[model samples]
Target: MSAYTTRQDLPGSLPAAASSALRLGALASDERFEVTVRVRPRAAPPDLAASAATLALKPAQQQQLSREEYAAAFGADPADLAKVADFARHFGLVVLDSSSARRSVFLSGTADQFAAAFGTQIEQVEHAGGVGRAVAAPLSVPSEVGDIVEGVFGLSDAPVARPHLQQLPEAQAAAGASFTPPQLAKLYNFPTGVDGSGQCIAIIELGGGFRTTDISNYFKGLHLPVPKVKSISVDGGKNHPTTANSADGEVMLDIEVAAGVAPKALICVYFAPNTDKGFLDAITAALHDKVNQPSVISISWGAAEKFWTPQALSSYDAAFQSAATLGVTVCCAAGDAGSGDENPDQGQPDGLAHVDFPAASPHVLACGGTRLKANGSSIASETVWNDDPLRSASGGGVSDFFDLPAYQNGAGVPASANPGGRVGRGVPDVAGDADPNTGYQVLVDGRRLVFGGTSAVAPLWAGLVALMNQKLGHHVGFLNPLLYGAAVGSGATHDITVGDIGAYQAGAGWDACTGWGSPNGAKLLQVLGS
Candidate 1:
């Protein structure tokens, strides 16, 4: 299960940045609450050193695992999971669901049962945009269960993640010509044949909805086949669209981008709440889903790493690790707020360098933003996306949380410039066009809208990865090792050398702003496919 919490050093209260002391109201004790118990991974991936060694070898020499095989090798111990479930039942919590592969136990009970079981109080707290219920105090479990439970999430109903997609205003949209995703794909030299048939792409969203008419109309306009699009709800979240929420734009952008590039691929959209619990559960569910079995998953929601709880961070990282063990490639947006990644609610920029989570997680491919200038079907000039200081910019920086992974050890990496004197993981392992000035056009809610952000890059990369899988006739899981290895210098990517993202600037090879750079799709397929 999870680490047994015994030491006093374990965090007692939520991070000041994550929880609020101000109570707006209180939740009724009779209300039902759904909480998740995240468990520890069965074991660390066989040996990071050995794994890298294998990656260095030819594709034929690489060891690959099917989902079932991977679960057998890396999933949580069943007995440990049972122990957690037993504890939940002891506290009068109903066992709603459990997944051994994801090492998670889902429980539901009245607010009174939850409060009594976890030794924490729940209260309605004031939050940005609206008021929500959340855990108001430190959570502590029995010594036995506390040791095994990695994180007790879903107790709080706080909204944490922000959708990375930003729609262009009417003025901005009318200012320039917007390119459809396929048009952009062609300019980037994405292969013409191999339309991602027989491949599945999973798009994760915190909130948003897309209409079938919008998607069908979009593909019809491009004179391409309309790929299958399906929605799966998680943690009571729905594909609900509202005029007040711009999240629907994010949902549509992700789907259209991936589907446009890989027109024949099946697109599965996972809609979850914007809270940490919902985000974590969605990822875990997507990672462990055996039916849809997406070859690649794209995420366009995230918050600054510092805003997440320790358990939240570890649990999410563990999920990414599991994706690596399985033959699944995950792509996440680096954020749109440059290096500062400041909280908008904080009044002004903190002037501190911060990185977005899920993107910063070592196991996933973090996609940054770029401004692309293309003439007809050829790329003109691409630079790091940096708009205005007060507005959006490509997010990239040394992480305040994760350490540098072994794959990131070589050239194009900088040493720690922070006070901690620790070399943390650098972001934007790969990048794509995300500037609204050169954004992707999509049909959302029956309206044609242009949007941009690192959000577009995640699904764009995921679609490219799906096409690569189709062309190679196999899944290329966990791209970092390959992207950083022998194929790096083999013309697989277009290195961006201009522009900056707040505190960090772009340069040759790798930089915090745009990493190795944008894709040269066909060449990448050839190099990585080999």
Candidate 2:
């Protein structure tokens, strides 16, 4: 018999993929696993309405809290933690670790123990990718702790996201123009005299790894000092570099672009597994890291919103809100798939428009893609990046998950191009060069390569944010509100008015294809500095 006689459903605990996956059979009773339980904040978080008002203010006027202060005010409640521990003990689970700042309690147990504790069965499942474990039913918690537990993760270890990166095909790798990060910075007129000194930029990688030798050689070729890079493991994930064809491209791309543009800033890379639990844990670890204290975070990994669980979406969004209050900026790749956002390589298109999450999260600076033809130091032509509509393009569309934010109210955000035309938040809040034809020249696993995608754009903006912070002597936290407000018409961004990505078209001002267009870094600095 279960320890608790009565249980309540844990809202949003079911995996979205579980519905379609073919269930094989129950897991072995003694199959061991570890899970993370996300709990509610000790106190209610700051009001969104008020936070919007505050974020709209100039950088100096914002009342940002330090990590210590934020933890004290909004971290997990001790009582809530104790209750969860008691519940875990009753079900024969061992408490692994807990963090007040991250509001997470880690536990280790067998399949049978977890099944009894959460009132759900773990089963071997067959999906398109391969066989894995997943929950077949909605998870439930004891009635006493139902409200305190926000999400239960790691019951299913299916892959959650893909790296938003595209390597130029070998056949055409030499056919188009590619610029090094420094050259693009010059073309974009990034602010000079600041090397992101006194700032730390955090990067999150779900897989692959980076070699110091590659980093040293890459920067040496560029004649830039190698930025200090450190890898922090999350959830047992490590810096295990493999071949160039693997996720190494993403890890290398993120590091090279960010460090290339902000050579003096400390780069802290948080490596984790590719599951939803690993993704969320990597993010929270980077945000709450007091030692490194990243002023901005760059995430080049994400999937379409449809692939995520509702609990995962809400939990990740809530973490971004914490970033805003702590004065840390988060830059996420808007995705490589176009408005449809379906994985063409895996199967046929779903024939419906979709947007990517983390980028779709209202709090993040969603970085989009553009194709640029530069005339020496100046941009001759720039437009929406859409080499292949179904397979590769700058991802943009109205989000089905999040409502329109106040800052985007006047940006002429359109309804979802899909049926029912639901109104929601638009993606790709900003843009950068991201076409494989005009991609960034990078070093991956000691091999020179050209990589593109909104993947590169996230780090591009992250490096720019670090430079901006160094120049302004403050973190330009939560830039979307200000970008839509004071920075409009300020010549801070070059408005791309050409090209289209299937469901959306590029326009003079804010459009779904490339919101407010690509950056003019010097002007952006002046706008934020003021």
Best of the candidates, TM-score: 2
Please give the lDDT score at residue 100 for candidate 1. Answer: 73
Question: For model 2, what is the C-alpha lDDT against the true structure?
Answer: 0.90
Model 2, position 135, has a per-residue lDDT of: 85
Model 1, 1-530: lDDT tens digits are 43434432225337536454368666788888788888765765653322457448543345667778877877777877888888788778999988878788899998888887787788877776477677777887777755567787888777778888767886889877678888888887887678999999999888868888888898999998988998899998788866424788888889899999998999998888888788988988888788999989999999788778877877788788778767688999999988877646444655667788889998889999999998777888999998863358898888777877888877456754456655688898999999998898888777777899999999999999899889888888878888888677888889999999877889989899999999888888777756
**What TM-score would every model get versus the actual structure?**
0.94, 0.97
For 1-530, candidate 2 gives per-residue lDDT tens digits of: 23567899988886453355788999888999899999999987663323447436786677788999999999999889989999999999999999999999999999999999999989998864478788878899998898999998899888888899999986677777999999999999999999999999999998999999999999999999988999999999999999999999999999999999999999999999888889999999999999999999999988888889999999999999899888899999998988887768955667889898889998899999999999999999999999888788999999998888887878899888988998888998999999999998988887888999999999999999999999898889878888888899999999999988889988888999999999999999898887
**Model 1: CA > 4 A from native:** 1-13, 16-21, 47-55, 58-60, 343-347
Provide the lDDT at 196 for model 2.
Answer: 93
Q: What is the lDDT of residue 394 in candidate 1?
A: 90
